[model samples]
Target: MNNDLYQEDIKQIKQQYACLDLTDDQAAFLLRHQNEPYPTHTEYYLNTWEHHDYEDHIFQKILNTAQFDHYLERREARLATHIAFLKQQDEEIKRNIEYKKQLLSYYCHTYVPQLLQTRLQYPNPFFAHRSKIRYIKEEYSNCCKVWKLRVTSQHFRNCRNYSPQLFELHMLDLQLLNIMPDYQQFKADADMPTQTTLTFLLDKSRCYLADFISFFDQKEAEETRTKKDAAIAVFGKAATSGWHIEPLPESNEERSNRLLFLLLMIEKVPDNGQANSCY
Candidate 1:
């Protein structure tokens, strides 16, 4: 791409754009960028002079100034195009975030809680017509009503009937074994755990049939926190470069996580002007 024959083109362009008032350094910069597809002033200056052939006066005579001017015009147009693209991308990202937030909120607060209530009401929906199952559902509902009222009371831990076994029994009656492709294996597992009263079994069964509402809610919070970390990492680089980066649309969980990160970082940073002065 480098040829000494472009000297004639440079002379003619130098005469035309004399009023450009470009310094020798600027001229050298323009020369180096003449061949670039989309050059930026920031990139041009950021590179070391040692990396430039013009610093050794190699390009002073042969560089095409007219092509350099065209490059600058093209670079400006390219930058404008990139900014427009970024704005469009940001708007799309914002819309997606809002949609996800709404979905997460609905799943956590309304859909899941109602689903849990439905499960408790008809643990064996397939056999819900039977009088025996109906009686069990009624008794379980009575227990749940009592459990809820006493849950916030001081004697919650002392209540003998507030058992995890109640939850486990309800889960077993849900006919989860029938739904499995390997029903025999699951039925075998279902029979063996007939004696255990561990909370883990209750949690596992609940999670398999219908995930625990609290656990789903916790996962939603964790997802938001992950998003916050990503946003911070993205925007922090823009901040250091003196570019104005827009904050991403965040859920309450995301905002809280972001604030927590900011507070922790602030505490870690030295109060004194000097770096590493915190010791």
Candidate 2:
């Protein structure tokens, strides 16, 4: 073998020996014999030590040390690069988390509300029942009442989900989905004495929308029950009659818009020409 290659092999053997559980004196003895050439086994090294050539052994020691130092330099360089990469990854993860929080805030405060208000201005044909329209308005109002009670960032974050802005968008989407054939049927029924009774029923149904808003509140179970009972009182026996109550949409974007619209309706007051007065 080439001298360099022989030195490298000897360095590897020394490293392996260093990892063993030897006492200091035993290690010193092992190191002293490292450069001595013997047969390939430990038994031969121990048997031949007395007759080993000193000049040849000292030459092997120099080559072994040089090879060991080269290996050490390479290991140190690799470790440094690995540590630097890990730190960069940690910082990137932190930045991504902050960006996500900011995005959620913007959706809650600005984007969702604008979308809801715009959709609410244009009434959907699917909700042609005047009563259903009135119910939508009342539910919107209830959402606003609930929002006003939110106190903390966590509360605000949760309340933001039920904002009327989100609700309005969802309502529009549902209308597009054509999920309101039964509601349309009720609107088409002309045999009823006047549209007033239908309008009254619609208002009663609208009251149940409060339950949906209340669900996001801290006191969700209590408020939901209270609002549900109140809605039943308005509906009376008709509440038990199996009129189709449109299921709430599952999408976060749709639900938020729907809730926002409900809040807007809750906050609005009809003008009685009384300056700055709200009931």
Candidate 3:
């Protein structure tokens, strides 16, 4: 890589590894040694600490004193403890991430869609019309910028309105969907950025949407078949005609976003959608 390009790459890497609490020198060292293979970010951090040169000028000054040898050993012990803590934190973060993925998968495929279907089929005019909601956005930047949303639903006293950051979690899910490895690779042109990547990404997204449609069709058919067959037993030919549910025409992205929004609202106000919030 060219010098400027390498520096940019280093900046990105530093952002990626920032959670490790890397100092400036350590961050630079990581960039320099990145050419060597490391299986994971944790391993890279561990190896960086292991091979770190303590003979630098900064350490040399402290090492020049008679009692410095004892202090150096104590400092090394503290550093070891800090590294262990970092590793422990890394493991904890991984666990939380896996749990988050499981929650998103369940909500996306089952809970959210199920609730949305129910709400669509059985509209609650009273609460639906009366409920008021407010949301605030918190934004941040790192390797990439994104928004964190906090939504509040208000209604009658003692009615459950919000479940803490649920909307933000859904927002995070949408963001993750956009940055999947397959999606990101589809958005890039080899090693460089290009304006044409937008068109390429859209095309790839359309293809994925087509596949999702097929999957949804199969799932929908399987689900309806069982329910409709059961309905026919109760009401005979009347049930055979079905309820004639029709969703509006929309792109895959539009549909997903709408469904997620509905899901978030339903989650915020579980019953009848009625709220009695002051604001």
The prediction achieving the highest TM-score against the true structure is 3
Off by over 4 Å in 3: 1-57, 97-189, 192-279
Sort order, TM-score high to low:
3, 1, 2
Q: Would you list the rank order by lDDT, best first?
A: 3, 2, 1
| Candidate 1 lDDT tens digits, 41-93 | 73243222233324235434434686455545654665566556644544545
What lDDT does candidate 2 reach at residue 45? Answer: 31
- Model 3 whole-model lDDT (C-alpha atoms): 0.40
Model 1 lDDT, full chain set: 0.37
Encode model 2's per-residue lDDT on 209-241: one tens digit a residue.
444444345333333444344435544444422
The worst-scoring run of ten residues by lDDT in candidate 1 lies at 261-270
Q: Alpha carbon lDDT of residue 232, candidate 3? A: 54
| Weakest ten-residue segment in model 2 by summed lDDT | 270-279
Q: How close is every model to the real structure, measured as TM-score?
A: 0.22, 0.19, 0.27
Candidate 1 wrong stretches, greater than 4 Å: 1-63, 92-94, 111-279
Candidates 1 and 2 compared by TM-score, better number? 1
1-279: candidate 3 lDDT, tens digit per residue: 798987787777668655444455655665666666756662133332343343233344433353345545655776677656655544444433443454344445554455546545434331332222112000011112221221122211111222223333444444433222122322232223332433333333343343234445555565455444544544454644434212245786755433332322343322322121211
